[model samples]
Target: MRKILLALLVSTIGFSQNKPFAKGADVGWLPQMEATGYKFYDTDGKEKDCLQLLKDRGMNSIRLRVWVNPNNDKASGHCSKEETIIMALRAQKMGFRIMIDFHYSDSWADPAKQFKPKAWSNHSFPELLNDVYNHTFDVINALKVAGVTPEWVQIGNEIPGGMLWPDGSTNHWDQLGQLLNKGYDAVKAVDKNIKVIVHVDEGNNNAKFRTFFDNATRQKVRYDVIGLSYYPFWIKKDYTEVIADLEFNLNDMVKRYGKEVMIVEIGGEDDKVENTYQLLATAIKAVKNVPNNKGLGVFYWEPQGARSWSHYNLSAWQADGKPSPALDAFKE
Candidate 1:
């Protein structure tokens, strides 16, 4: 009886109902005039044009990054809070769902640098928690005021090292959990339906993903998502490793943790991004083949952001509007 019970429990834990691979785009590097070589906010604010183009190309959702106070237009800090709402508003009007990514500060928020927004630059850990609440509320509120509610909101980008730094660092997931929950609660408070994502850098670490989520849940922090970043460089050339790691993480999250997984961010070098994309798409199919649809979806990172600051500012797109082999990696 114990053997039968264990088998049933394990099977129940390992399989889940089919989940759709929600098609998406993180327009973090959405083309500004400068980002597109056009020179001004002309192309920058032409969100309608941008979204229309993306939708025309098969994109159904758009994610925009919010920087608290970026130094220049070339940076995402270029995205003003107002601009984000406006973009969100426009994206919805045009039929595309939207996601707002809070970098927490004015510059780019990633695994490397999740500096606190300048406004919170002087606050202590406790005070900083309040700031996270207020900041998250303020942004979500603004979008509401604009008559544009986002479908999802990521509290911070690539928060593996922790966010708002000095205080919310990984060394203290306790503090980090409390702080992140503040943002999570702020989001839920506004639109209880809005999905919340706690992102980390690599998607291949099956064990790491489990530890992170298990830790968060144990702390009583309820989040709606598990977002991951998967760059080939970070995983190395062994496509088999990438496939194996992704499958393990996706299944483990759903079957073991009951958490839906999303490849919130992913890309390879310009030259290999195409090949990387194909392999990734194939991997998705492989996951779906597992008794049940545990694999959720993936979002290509900044494919349209162009090659401006590329490791050398080279072009990242193909001659055609479609994704290069790399971006094509997710092709259905």
Candidate 2:
């Protein structure tokens, strides 16, 4: 009876994972832009809700990032728990699946910087672990109360070097693994159906992915998905090379880890709109080509705002407030 019950539980957990081809976008800045009176328009120059425009373009999921005590840095306060919930509620109502990215910091949490939240700076290792658990649980609980259940949750963002600064850096894989497990456990505690993703940048770099996942596996870190950030321009690799490398990595990751993979974030230059379209289309194709349907999908990062609001030159929007043809790649 015990063996049967254990197998049933394991099967139930695996069955809860998302099976859809997650054509998504990381629109963490959307709510902040809307609050400042910015409106999105379609190619026809007709004003429309940003989420609706993406939905019309075939995007099925929205990824939002949440900061812990963003008030510690006023400029970085836009993605606070409350603001994320507001944006998430909008996406949920529009029938778009949601993915919550926890930055574990007051500001940006990327390869270059993953500063500890000011409130957690002085915490010991155990205290920091508890803080991570409590923050994740609180935010997820609040979102649930708001009637929004995120389909996927990223424990951290672009964490190629690991997160939470020196203590949880890649050199300290045990600590990093522990912190990540705290987050994974928190999400499962809230809802077992919500998949947890461990994200890293450089989707085409198989070496990096292997190293990170190897350490994670050694430490028994639990995760449901392998999320990657792919930017061809940053790597200075042309479209063909980028897609080939991405496909190779995606296949290897699935086979090695037995986990689903996704291009959690991707972008290209607006000046080269056609190239950007080709880039996105090629990436989606590469992901879909992963055998056994282990390739989940791709997500474009911050495609809505262009100039002043985001200053992202690679934005998938034209100057006239219309979505650039580059976004048409999602139609695939």
Which of the numbered candidates is closest to the native, going by highest TM-score?
2
lDDT of 1 by residue, 1-332 (tens): 99999999888776543334566677655545334553211123333354555555456777888877666656444777877776787778888778888888878778778777777799888898888888899999889878988877898888867788878887888898998899999999899988898888777787777777777777777788778777656656555557777767766777776666677776655666556656657655644654444455666666665554433222235333333445444445
Q: Candidate 2 at residue 316, lDDT? A: 89
Which stretches of model 2 miss by more than 4 angstroms? 1-18, 72-75
Question: Model 2, residue 163: what's the lDDT?
Answer: 96
| Candidate 2 C-alpha error for residue 237, in Å | 2.3
Badly placed stretches (over 4 Å) of model 1 are: 1-20, 34-50, 286-294, 308-316, 319-332
Candidate 1 global TM-score: 0.82
lDDT of every predicted structure (CA atoms): 0.70, 0.89
How does model 1 fare in lDDT? Answer: 0.70
The TM-scores, one per candidate, come to 0.82, 0.92
Error of 2 at 79 (Å): 0.6
Report how far off residue 331 is in candidate 2 (Å).
1.2
